[model samples]
Target: MLYKVLEVPGIEYIVLDFKSSDGNFIAQDLDDSETWNAKAFYQWLIDEVLVFTDDGISGMDKDLYKQFKAFANQRGVCVCDSRKI
Candidate 1:
């Protein structure tokens, strides 16, 4: 797993790249190119990038996503899937 923090003038976001024998998982904001905070970034990462199925399944690794959620929570960011509600 490799990650990078992108910081610009007024925007900041983290890009997480996880590689495994199955495939590569890259977490980022896919809908929009701009991000402002960890909350929004993680929210979008889960909602848009992960794109959970109706059965609550995503292509990403479950453990990795769990770690991402924990990291976001530590930073006061809610990475809950809005579409599930």
Candidate 2:
């Protein structure tokens, strides 16, 4: 998928731009949570974006959502968050 990474004041986000069938391009934000791994980010795309909500801002299956934390943990998703950078 084609996307862009943006850094705002206190947050970094991934922008997923989808062109609608009618030719309108809509951008969706997926909070990066500071993860920089391609594999982990791919999983985030599956677990957080695709599984939860296409727009990245809606409900997810409870069981699936609950498992994401553990999944993310195993992938070291939050490793960079507490770093001094």
Candidate 3:
């Protein structure tokens, strides 16, 4: 499964990009985007139009905890293991 992090204003989101059982590409924005597609998803994530999470993480489809831990390191966003929080 492909994964991405996004944010708009006061909200942060995690986007899960995957294929449906019917063989069609599907995108689900964790915080809810009814119009996002895989076509420009990467660009959106890279543009910094969305910021990384600094509080908590979402999206269980991917190993989001581990993924965000690394992401937080690079961006200086502190993230702790949920089990310990």
Candidate 4:
């Protein structure tokens, strides 16, 4: 499987592209994207956009967190997480 993150003009949220089971490409807004095989768009957000600690503890990089919060607020999107709900 492959994943891609995209930004479309006139859209409030980011966009995502991935392959479906039928080998067709599907596009959806970030908040509405699906998770398959434990891989999701939020993983890209965490790995690329946000700074997080991976030492088996629930810790955040304060400065990066602040920046991310501001960015999310400005864009009207939620912060990165495994589950959006």
Top candidate by TM-score: 1
Q: For model 2, what is the error of residue 48's alpha carbon versus the real structure, in angstroms, after optimal superposition?
A: 9.2
lDDT of 2 by residue, 30-67 (tens): 65335334444644454444423343223444444445
- Candidates in order have lDDT scores of 0.50, 0.39, 0.43, 0.39
Top-scoring candidate (lDDT) = 1
TM-score of candidate 3 relative to the true fold: 0.30
Question: Model 1: residues >4 Å from true position, as ranges?
Answer: 1-33, 53-57
lDDT of 1 by residue, 1-85 (tens): 1242122111244554445343334455445654335455555555555555553335545666566667767656676666766
Model 3: per-residue lDDT, tens digit, 30-79?
65555455434433443434333444443332465467455444544444
Off by over 4 Å in 2: 1-39, 42-57, 79-85
- Candidate order by lDDT, highest to lowest? 1, 3, 4, 2
Tens-digit lDDT track of model 4 for 1-85 = 1121121112345433434564333335567664322133334454454333433113443554566455444444455553333
Over 4 Å off, model 3: 4-17, 20-24, 49-85
- What residue pairs are clashing in model 1? none
Model 3: lDDT of residue 74: 52
Q: What is the TM-score of each candidate against the true structure?
A: 0.47, 0.29, 0.30, 0.29
